[model samples]
Target chain A: MNLIFWSSESDDDRRDTQVGSWLGELDPGRDDATYWMRFHRDVVDGSRFELARRRQAAELTVVGVVSSWSRTLVPVALAAAAAAGIMLAQPRLDQVEPPILVEDVLTMGLGDPMPALFVDDEEGGLLLASEIY
Target chain B: MTSHQKIEDPRFGDGELVRRAREGEEEAYALLVGRYMRPAYLVALSVTRRHEDAEDAAQEAFLVALQRLEECRDPERFGGWLMTIVRNRSRNLLRRESLRETSVLPETAKSGEPLPDRVTERSELDETLQAALAELTPVQREVVLLHDLEGWKHREIAERLDLPSGTVRSHLHFARKALRGKLEGVLTDHVKG
Candidate 1:
């Protein structure tokens, strides 16, 4: 007989059934509406939830602003770094002599028949590749 | 399930409610809490066993859920996400209860004095119900409560609990059978038409 009507006889399915109203009464919603109602209020209106919400909102605001700033500042900072990189990539001015010296060019360009560089050697004299050989 | 068991607000779905709550709408939050309150309580009850602990766990879970609402990722599945929090909080409470068991005796621990509202005749039945529930596995208790108490379909229980439909039915069958066995005399006496 139960095989045909298990669904209907199932204890306190709570659909117009007195089979297990006691179990249904155990439900907090039914048993203690006052307490659960207070619980709902506490969750929505209690200072604890409000404080937590405000705290989260503040933290999110701070994070949101910082992230927005990063979105803008990050590329600009990167480009500035890139510009510095280009300048650094170039040879240092302090390590190298000038491309041309008026004195060396004047005297050596006149004296040197062999087409050569008129760069002054470490001794402050014009040096030629042919002379070194 | 009763009409009150599900979403109290038919106008707004869980997603819209979550979005509104995230935008700091207290009404939306109240709706959300009202919607999930029973389910959350039942889930916590499935784990914590004690009603007061279950209530505490459920309330704490709601607060934690609100605090971490943004991390929910899928607003549409707010119920599932809240259930997860409820489960975790229940487990945490159980662990705390286990730890506290050694050091402190609970005031409500069935003293000679009758518990409030617990008329002697009814309290014995309540104790029998609790004892029967204790005999069930957590999953069994959950399945039975969700199915019989909430009037959920087996398939709904399966999807919500991630169990096969057959398994849900099996659990429901066994859980009810066990409760019937445990409360045979009391159930016969209390059965009204």
Candidate 2:
């Protein structure tokens, strides 16, 4: 019953099965061996594997050396140069400007500092010394 | 240990080899190269048909495999992963050659020994098979080579190719059918000759 049920296979299945049988009957010793052996001994040997290997090794080495050199040396060298440059230019930066202060603003309002007073308005705010008529 | 025991692969039954390779064991990679280099080269040659191109593709494949070993989802499935790299590299090499040779040879001339051996009937069979294989589209050729020549199972082939098993089945079916037809045609000619 099971065989009967499985028997109605498609044309593709039948064809594939036949091919599979042919594939099974193929002697690996005679044809495949000769072709593979010849291909390996002759063609593969003549290829550019050696050149590629050397190139790969050189590329890796250069990358590694450059990476390490950059990691350790570049930062230290840059930092030292920057520090030296700043040391050389310190006085120039210092003489550029003095910061603003509260005393500077107060002196501007008082006009030679006669005496100072203050008052407050109901709506807005505080009035400064000269306006305290 | 007995010779039988000693003949057992040092890297077998342990994922340690993969771990070591990941940790930069060039020797472990060398061991892998020693193992797969021949088969990989053969596959490359079969696909590209050029001696120089095959060797370059095989070496590039091995290098790529080593570099991308971390992407190997299953450490034990390393061989299949390596084969995928070989296939991809060989295809890339062939594509480049095709582009370069387009102006020179409009039809990409396969690079095997052009003369068929006349001595043995078996050699004729090989020649026929080789020619038939060459006639296949690259996808069909790849599927046939992976499944028939390399002895990979459908599931394995599907996974390696990142295709569904059903698609792999369809490809294999068509490839084998095409090959059988080609072989039958050649056989008829050879018999006449």
Candidate 3:
């Protein structure tokens, strides 16, 4: 997995804040919590250095883990989700919305909310949107 | 071979380096990377107009160049070939990430003021040049930077940019004119100071 970090002014911090908040929702007791903490620390340290060098006012940084998704896993994930949905009255599978077309996603306005259907743990690690369906 | 040996050989030119690199010589490839990294970064920066993006694009271009080293017909012009890859990669990145969000002008331009008199003449000139370069269209900047800064001929720039030689000449002419117009005041001020 590759770790990506982005830093910007606080006024332009919307994207980082949103991604940070989403990551915060994950259970801290999970096995991957350590990885997230390390990623966060790296981001904070990197942002501090960058901000100090640039002398920018009110810097913010966001970090995320990105892993490649295998093509074969798509069908497997779909089958598992469908099976789990049929077994449970409240279908978590329904939460896995159809993958948005790349063109449609590209056309979306900057302010539009991105669909967050796929979870990162196919190989038990974070998968980027580009990596996932 | 040791780094000392690589540096010592007068006959070991770019073609020799390319041949060695093709034969799995890591030292030869490193030498090539060292030689071209700056120019490659400049080419990418001309397109992307951002330092970080330019660095990333240049690094990726080197890797791609290494992988496709066999495809190079003339090792003598490896710099131009690698630059072509860098240009394409930078343009592809610009397309993928909408340029509207990423194409920011330099900080000097955003600050919107000439530097104080205490600033060195060279520093002022650099800042003015940066700002003027930022003002140019991407294609114009690319042509001007390659031709003027890199000392590439119009034919070389045209081949890499995939434009006609006449168009490259035209772009270079207009870009220089625009730069001169933008910098005239700064130059005059510097001289008077």
Candidate 4:
């Protein structure tokens, strides 16, 4: 006879209970409990970290990679910052600009609209954009 | 019905932990997660019926629970509340995933290939157990896993699940019976080995 509310007596039934217990393994092991602890610590401390960087750098300087999804998720703040930097470095989309010729493309990064001296084939030597006809 | 507070000497009660967590104490929140992770996962498995989806749903639910800590009106019953989040997350995952894929037995297991080591045996056994668990009703699965696996009392399961204690017992009795029937060979071999 089976007793639900009492200690199970039958060993076969006991073993069955263990089989049910084994399903707990489907949860990530206790290591995840620790990993998430550390991850939350980093989040609380305002220390930004990357899973890929932790792997490449040979040291978990900030947060450790906790799971498989670590490889896929870039730190959103880092991605946003990188994107913003690239956008700022590029010319404003709203501004009208000349199409990039070879020399103009080469000179595009010199500075913020600085008067760059490029070799002028028409005038034969280094001349500022203002000096060019 | 007893809370895990009575099962083990956790340093703080769920109400206290929830309060501390809401106050930005990561340690308290981590403790809560550690304490309830398995129960949360089991609850998720009840709804998802797939280990992978259950794991995702459990983790997502924990995150969501943490985010909405303020909304947990009854922090003392945090386990019950978290289980609700887990169930909702699992159902939402099902709705979103639309039954992605069933657990297929590993190729080696299906081919009758020799399991070279203990690792393979455990892996195969785990999948088999999952498949067997799929046969039980959702409530039965939840009751059995919580009562048998997590070692919760029948009354605790009843309170958490909002079922009568007697009903919880009946579910457990029948769930174990069903599992015994389906897992007879596997369980016998496991018992012997």
Candidate 5:
């Protein structure tokens, strides 16, 4: 449940950090370079197996894991923290001001003659901007 | 007949490839990957801005696309569909790793094999271009790279990025102006040195 986030400069740094942590949990006297290598390999293999197991348990194909991994490398807790940060940092779409329309700018230039201006719509139909408003 | 036998007919279009892939033909799927991998990587790189991350995202997108191959309404437009997947995956990666620090200029690998002087000069230019590209916003960078670097038309770029054609044109214009300014500065600095 304790997911250590890898923020190291390189993959080697991540591997070393992970290996060092794993070695600390084991018998130091018995952990040789070969043992460490095997342990590292097993950890990586185990991660893959865990991913496959979870995918199958959820009744999803291996391909479904692609989307899940693409969405987040963090666990639920860390992802929640990220979501909270994002909510606090970014303004909601409704809260943000709408883009200034070309018609609005043109009307502004014309000394507020009217709030309407002819513009081409998405379907190539000419309509008054104020009509839509 | 086997997929290999089908492929040997010399008339295997993208639509045919999709059909074969949907039939669980691994060779057909591999062919599709070979066809789109470079453009997919380029599209992803434009968004991710990191070679390794772009590569990973592109590879993931391929898997996702393969899974959803049946959902493609028009198999002839598979390249565009695959590109959309790549762009989405790249954007997802960007959002997930938003907090990660990124270098302004990505490191370029020197070729181990000997290259002609012209090739080396072009490579340096490409490096400068990439550095300038790093300055643009992600959307601007994507449009510019797709239109200019990948030689995609504005309409094609718009479809791939799910933007209006006019919007694509606007982004391309601004990106080109910015890139020209940056490249000029680099050239001036080179001349001074």
Candidate 6:
């Protein structure tokens, strides 16, 4: 005859009961509880440590790479961009001029009053203005 | 040493390890990893099934947890926090792979015996648990494995998974019921023989 017991129980309790119940029915002739004990041992031994370590190492390596890349690349990229901007702006700085350009213009066109926007007394600039009017 | 002392003692517990780790103690983090690696991998393997996949998920989870360790609110509950990372990574991997066609693989029983009247050993129990876990919805399986294997309480699980306590309880209930039903049938058949 076969009968099953079902109940809502805590896991640890269920685990213990399940182990006991399953083994009780086995009826192995040996006086030793080796089989039952081994069952518990095997359940406890389900953990695999070596593979887990290797996996952890591989993961740390990946994280190290990503973190280093971000830390190094971001600043380097920003500095490189800043350097490029300074290099590109160098020629533009030379285009700025002082008031000396007005002096040069006066030197070239001083004899021509209308062109220079000033009237020279030696050229009768005031008379020429009166005659044109 | 007592497991309770190991888990609950503030000076020697996972929370202490996290506090030390956050303070730049690399050894503390390493110890924490050593302590939780098996359970973490088991949870991942429960979801992914394949060793390689589980390893990837487990590693990624740890790395993520390490990177964001500062964000953990209660360092005393480090195990629960790390476990959440494991489940999240596993779920994300599963989602990414969901588009591809895949089928649940059968467990390799100890012998070539047929289904009815088959003896279930402890190794078989582990394998059966893995297979049944794989067959569950990711969320359900995660809650179940965390509760059963890792011995996490419902509130701890809910906090880690960012789920409602009621939802965690319901998932646990359903998963336990399903697994029990499956195992009961197999055991009853074997007893009849």
Query: Which candidate has the highest DockQ of all?
Result: 1
Among all windows of 10 consecutive residues in model 2 chain A, the one with the lowest summed lDDT is A1-10
Q: In candidate 6, residue A107 scores what lDDT?
A: 95
The runs of at least 3 residues in candidate 2 whose Cα sits more than 4 Å from the true structure, single-residue gaps closed, are A1-133, B1-15, B42-46, B50-52, B71-74, B102-127, B185-193
TM-score of every candidate relative to the true structure: 0.64, 0.47, 0.44, 0.54, 0.45, 0.45
For the candidates in turn, chain A alone yields TM-scores of 0.30, 0.31, 0.18, 0.18, 0.20, 0.25
Candidate 1: misplaced stretches above 4 Å?
A: A1-20, A29-33, A47-133, B1-7, B103-122, B191-193
Evaluate residue B3 in candidate 6 and report its C-alpha lDDT on the 0 to 100 scale.
Answer: 20
Model 4, C-alpha of B177: deviation from truth (Å) = 0.4
Looking at model 2, give its docking quality level.
Answer: incorrect
List model 1 lDDT by residue over B1-193, tens digit each.
Answer: 2424343787898899888777667778888898888778888998987778888998889888887878988898888788889989999998987787656654665465544533345466667788888998988888777767766666566666767766766677787788878877775565442
Lowest summed-lDDT stretch of 10 residues in model 5 chain B? B1-10
- lDDT score for candidate 6 against the true structure: 0.60
| Model 3: CA > 4 A from native | A1-133, B1-13, B99-131, B154-165, B187-193
TM-score between candidate 1 chain A and the true chain A: 0.30
User: What is the clash tally of candidate 4?
Assistant: 0
Model 3 CAPRI rating: incorrect
- lDDT tens digits by residue: candidate 2, A1-133: 0111222223232223334333332323223445434433333243335434544555566678889789999899999999999899777676867887888977776656555476677767879867766
What does the i-RMS of model 1 come to? 5.6
Which residue pairs clash in candidate 1? none
* Docking quality class, candidate 1: incorrect
User: How would you order the candidates by lDDT, starting with the best?
Assistant: 1, 4, 5, 3, 6, 2
True A-B contacts kept by model 2: 0.03
lDDT of 2 at A14: 26
Q: Model 5, range B78-148, lDDT digits (tens) per residue?
A: 88889889989999998776543233222331434443322433345446656777887778877665555
Q: How good is the docking of model 6, by CAPRI class?
A: incorrect
Which is better, 1 or 5, measured by DockQ?
Answer: 1
How much is A17 displaced in model 2, in angstroms?
12
Worst 10 residues of 2 chain B by lDDT: B1-10
- How well is each residue in A53-119 modelled by candidate 4, as lDDT tens digits? 3224433334544432465555765798899999899988779876779998888778777544665
RMSD of each: 10.4, 13.7, 33.9, 20.7, 34.6, 13.0
Model 4 DockQ reads 0.06
Residue-wise lDDT of candidate 3 within A1-133, one digit each (tens)?
1222222222121122221222122212123434323433333333333324322321222211112234566778999999888789665666887889998888779786767755678578877677766
